[model samples]
Target: MPSQNEPAEPLAKGIIPTAKQQFHDLFVWKQRVVITNEYGETRTEWVTPEPLQNPISLFMQLSLKGWLYFLVGLAAWTADAFDFHALSIQTYKLADHFDTTKTNISTAITLTLLLRSVGAAIFGLLGDRFGRKWPMIANMLVLGLLQIATIYCATFSQFLAVRSLFGLFMGGVYGNAIAMALENCPVAARGLMSGILQQGYALGYVLAACANLGVGGETETWKTVFWIAAGISIGVGLVRVLFPESKQFRQKADVDESVHTVSAKMFLEEARLMLTREWKMSVYCIILMTWFNYYSHTSQDSYTTFMLTQKQMPNDAASRASILMKTGACVGGTIIGYLSQWVGRRRAIVVSALMSGFLIPAWILPRSERALSATGFFMQFFVQGAWGIVPIHLNELSPPAFRSVFPGVTYQLGNMISSPSAQIVNAVAESHFVTRGGERVEAYGPTMAVATAIIALGIMVTAALGPERRGSRFELARRAGDRVEVGKDVEDVVMDAEKPATVQREKMDEIEKK
Candidate 1:
C-alpha cells in the first residue's frame, strides 16, 4: 500500500481531478485498503467504489474493554447534556421564578456558553498533558456542585453568575469524553459508536424534558430538574473513579517513559508545534462547529416556547413534544451515524442537512398537538442526524498528539461564537408579532424555521466542501529501544529505528518545518 501522505493516483495520464470532480468524489462510495501494523493496530484507506463489511458485523468487532471506555464516556456526556438542557427546557419557569423576562433569563445561557471555551482550553490541555482521568473527575464534580449552586441563587444576577461558572466546567467534558470513547474503539465500529456517543446530548435533553413533564409546569419545579441533573453529574464523576486511565493514554505514557523523560516543557512544546502546523484545519473545524452549534441551538432551544406561544399548547403538551423531538434526535443520530461508516461522513451530513431543510415548513406550520409532535420528531431526526457524525469526524481531523485538546477547544470555541443563538431566537421572536386567531402572538415559529433553514444550508455547504480523514490511526506506542528527541524529525527517528512510521510523526514533521 502507498504511504498515507502520497498524493492520490491521477485519474488518467497523470492528470489531476478538477474541483468539481473532487466534490463529486465526496459522495462516491470507495473500496478501502485495511492495513494492520506490527502493534496489531489497523487503519483503512479509501481506494475505489465497492461494497464493504456489514454494519452489524462491524459493531460486533469492538473488544470488551473498548465498550467499557465508550460507555463511561457516554455517561459523562449524557450527564453534561442533562445539566444544560435542564435550564434551557425550563426557560419560562426560570423567567417566572426570577421575576424576569424569558429573554433576560436567556442571559444565563449566553454566559454559560461564552465562558465554556476557557474551560475547554484549560482542562483540555490538562487532559492532554497530565491525563484524561483527574481533570475530567474534577470537571464533573464541580459541575454537579454548580448545579446545586444554581438551585440556591435567589436573584437572577446570582443565577447568571452560577451558570457562567457552570459553562467553564461543562466546556471540559466533550473533548475528554470523546477521546476516551472513540480512541479505543475499533476503526470499523467508530462511526456507529460516534453516533451513539454524540446522542448523549440528545438523550440528556430527553431526560430533562421527562423530568420537566413529571414535575409539572409550576414556576418552582425547574429546581427539581436541576437537583436531578446534579445527582447525575456527581454520580458519573464518582463512577469514573472506579475505572483506569484510557488504554491508549497508558500505553503512550509507558513508551514515553522509556524513549524520553516526559516533562511539562516537552508536552507544551509538542502542543505549540501541533497548533503551528494545524492552525488552518483548526480554523476550519471551529467554523464548522460554530455553524453546528447554531444548527442545534436555533432549532431546539426555543422549540417548546414556539409550541407554547404560536401553537397555543399547554406546558405539559409542549414538554411532551420536546421529549419526542429529542427522542428523534437520539434515533437519527444513531442510524445516520451507522450509515456514515458506509456512505462516508460528509455525504451523510450533507444529505441529512438537505432533508432537514425541506422539513422546516412541516416542522413549524402544524398547530395541533399530534401534528406538532410528529413534525418535531422527523425534523430533529435529520437535524441531529447530521450532528451524530461530529464527534468522530472531529477526532479524525484532529492532530494525533492533541486529540483531547484539539476537538475540545475547537468545539467549545464554536460554542463561544454561537453562544447567543437562543438569545437571538428569543429576541427576534419576542420583538416580532404574528396575528393568531385575531390576536397578536410572538412569531417564534417563523423565526426558528428561517434560522434552522439557513443553518441547514450552511451545514451542507461547509460539510461538502471540507475535508475528511475517515480512518486515521490513534495508537502512539513505540517498540523498546526507540528514542525520541524534542524538536527533531520524530518520524525519521522512528523509521531509522526500524519501526513503522506513525501518523503523529508525519504531523510533527509538517508542524516543525513550518
Candidate 2:
C-alpha cells in the first residue's frame, strides 16, 4: 500500500491515468477458497486503514476560508432539504387542499425525484464550464421563485407543474453547492466537515418539523411553510452572491484558458471521457446510493405510522420518537464522519452498517414508547453514521474536472431509482398485516427491520469492495496529474497565483517537470 502522505499510485510525470486505467490496475478476481481448521478460518482481508490523528487537532487546523466554503454548502443543502420536506410532511394537507388523493399528491414528489438528474446534468455542467458561482446563484434564486409560485398555485395541476420545476432547480443546487464547498476545503478536514455537511439534510427535516409545528401542522397553513422556505432559500442565494469565487475554481479556469478557453464543447468532451472511462465506478456509486436511499426512506417514512398503529403509541410519543431518532442521526453522523479520518472512510462506513444490523431487534421489538425511542436513537445512530461518509466519499472518487456533476448526477440518479421506496415498504408491510387487539395492524416493524438488515449488509459489502482515495487532492491541476507530492498542500496554488511574474513562471516550470 502507498503511504498516506503519498499521491495515489499510477502517476507518471504527475499525470494519472483515466478511471478505466485505474480500475484495470486495481481490479482483482479472487476465489473464496480457504482452508478451515479447528484452530481458525483464514481469508484475505482488504482493509487499508488510515493513520490516526487527535480529534481536537483535526478541527483546530481549518482555515477561515475553508469553514466559509463548508458552511455555505451546508446552509444551501439544509435549506433545500427544508423546502422539500416541508412539502412532504404536509402531504395530507396538500391532498386535502387540492382535493386529490394522497397517491395523486405523491406524484408530484415522484416528479421531483425523477427529474432531478436532468437538473443535475444541466447545472453541474454549467458550474464546471463557467464557474461554481453564478450557476448556484441561479439555482437558488429559481428554487425560491418556485416556492413562491407553489404558494399561489390554485389547482392541483398548477401545484404539480410548479413543483416539477422546483425539483429541476433543486437538483442543480447540490452539485454547485458541494463543488463550491469541498473544492476549497483542506483534505485533512474533509471527512469531519462532510459528516457535518451531510446532516444538513436531517437538519432541514427537523426545521420543517419546527415550521409545521409553528403553523399548527394544519392543511390550510402549509402555504405559510412554503413562504418561510422561500424566504430562507432566497436569503441564502443573496448571501452566496457575496462570497468570492473559490480559489480552486479560479485556478482551474486559468488552466483551462491556458490550454484552450473553457467552453461547452470542452465540458462535453470531459463528460464523454468520464462516462466512458469511469463507467464502472459510476455504476457502482449509483448502486450504493440506491441501497442508501432505500435504507433511509424505508426505515423512517412509515416509522411514525408504525409507532401509532402497530405499537399503539400516542401521536405525541411517536413524534418524540422521531425527533430522538433524528437527533441520533445528527450526532452519529458527525462522530463517525470525524472518526473516518483516522480509521479510513470505507472502514468507518462498513463498521457503522454492521453495527446498525445488531441494533434492529432492539429497535423494532420495543413495546413501550420510552424503549422505542431509546432503540430508535441507537438504530439511527448507525444508519445515518454510515450515510455521513457519502458526500465526501462521492466527491473524493469523482473525476476532478467533473466532480460537481459526477457526485450530483450519481446521487440524483440513485434517488430516482429509489423514489418508490416508501410505497414499496408500505405495500409490503400491509401484506404482512397482523391481527393485534382484534384490529389489523400493518407489520411495519418486522418489515422495516428485515429490509434495513439487508441494506446494512449490502452497504458493508459494497463499501468493502469499493475504492478509497483518502487524502486525494481536489484541485484541477493535481487531479489532472492525479498526484499530490507528499507534504505539499494544494492550497499553495492560491499563493502561486499571487506570485511575481518570474516566480510564477518558475512555479509553472516546476509543476510541468513534476
Worst 10 residues of 2 by lDDT: 29-38
Best TM-score goes to which candidate?
Answer: 1
- Residue lDDT tens for model 2, 263-343: 455346546766776788898899888888877877876676678668887555666777788788889998898888767
Q: Return the TM-score for each candidate structure.
A: 0.89, 0.81
Error of 1 at 25 (Å): 2.6
Model 1 vs truth, CA RMSD: 5.3
Candidate 1 ranges beyond 4 A from true positions: 1-22, 31-46, 49-56, 251-256, 476-514
- Assess candidate 1 and give its TM-score to the true structure: 0.89
State each model's CA lDDT, in order. Answer: 0.83, 0.73
lDDT of 1 by residue, 232-325 (tens): 9999999889888886446455333543545676566666656676787898899999999999999999999888888888999999999998
